[model samples]
Target: MFSKIVIACALVALCQAGFLHYHEAPIHYSAPDHFTPSQSYEAPAIHDEPAHEDHYVDEYAYPKYGYSYSVEDPHTGDHKSQHEERDGDVVKGEYSFLQPDGSFRKVTYTADHHSGFNAVVHNSPPVIHNH
Candidate 1:
């Protein structure tokens, strides 16, 4: 019980310190007294740009991500995998799993501007055991 209490206190202190470290102090600003209306300083004149003038800017951006995961059967020493990704207007995904008879099955998906959408599946032939 004492050790638990000590660990809890240490965790609380660490969390408090982390919060304080990441916190930012607010900024306070004030204009100098010399800029008040009583001073003779004149404000600068402003000019407006003419409209209908063309301004050009170009940008290229895309998002792409992919990750894979696997689950293993601790007793059987077998595993399955899954993955997915998306780039710009295209997306793809897949998953594969092991079968009980020493075979694997895989399924996939794809979509894009031209092909629209499609799904494909493949299966490994079941293992044949001969006596």
Candidate 2:
């Protein structure tokens, strides 16, 4: 029992000695944040592709059956013009328009029974502006 008491006292002394040797890390206070209000942004100018509409269809095989090309899309072709023409059973056209997210969507399509309706769409990422 006496040995147990001495052991307990020695353990406490050892703990205190270890505690005295330990040192706390230095503390530093950060500077307060300062932010400036953002400025209003202006819109960028849109450069839409011009129309290349043909007055009449030109075809060696069938001039009368030849189709003149042009399509005004309701969704994205507000001020944009598309190219389209019917070469007998086959039809082809291309058009481009701006997106709401400042991206560009261009589509080239062809339709026929042999190849079916095929559309090749090209998408461009939006450009960021700093104001």
Candidate 3:
């Protein structure tokens, strides 16, 4: 039993000595010769300029469509106006208006629909006055 104790003590002492030696060993490391310590960065100088007048631009300088409007009167059953739309090669529109002489004028328009287009306007003859 005494021999076993002595052997264990010797093993513990050897292990401790080896651990200490490894931790105490000096480590060597060196930076490359071409590398230099970075210096503090300095911002570049800027020159101020005088303020200028504000400029404005008109995005909608032109109208999108030629003309568009509508009117309706329930009492007289009088109504007029039209709208036109174009899709691909087809265009169509219709419009009608009541004249001051109690007459009605109607217009129809069509273009590029099945490779054909036409405009027709219907208006009554002007009333002749004997006076």
- Give me the candidate number with maximum lDDT: 1
lDDT (10s digit) by residue, model 3, range 1-131 = 99999999999988888543455679899987796879988898887988888989767543233456798997986678987876566677888887767678889998884759798999976555678
Clashing pairs in 2: none
**What lDDT does model 1 reach?**
0.87
Best by TM-score: 1
Worst 10 residues of 2 by lDDT: 62-71
TM-score of 1: 0.44
* Candidate 2 per-residue C-alpha lDDT over 52-76 given as tens digits, one digit per residue, 9 for 90 to 100: 8878866558522333344566675
In model 1, the runs with Cα more than 4 Å from the true position are 1-62, 74-78
Task: Order the numbered candidates by lDDT, best leading.
Answer: 1, 3, 2
Error of 2 at 106 (Å): 0.4
Instruction: Provide the TM-score for each candidate, comma-separated.
Output: 0.44, 0.41, 0.34
After superposing candidate 3, which stretches have Cα over 4 Å from the reference? 1-70, 74-78, 113-117, 124-131
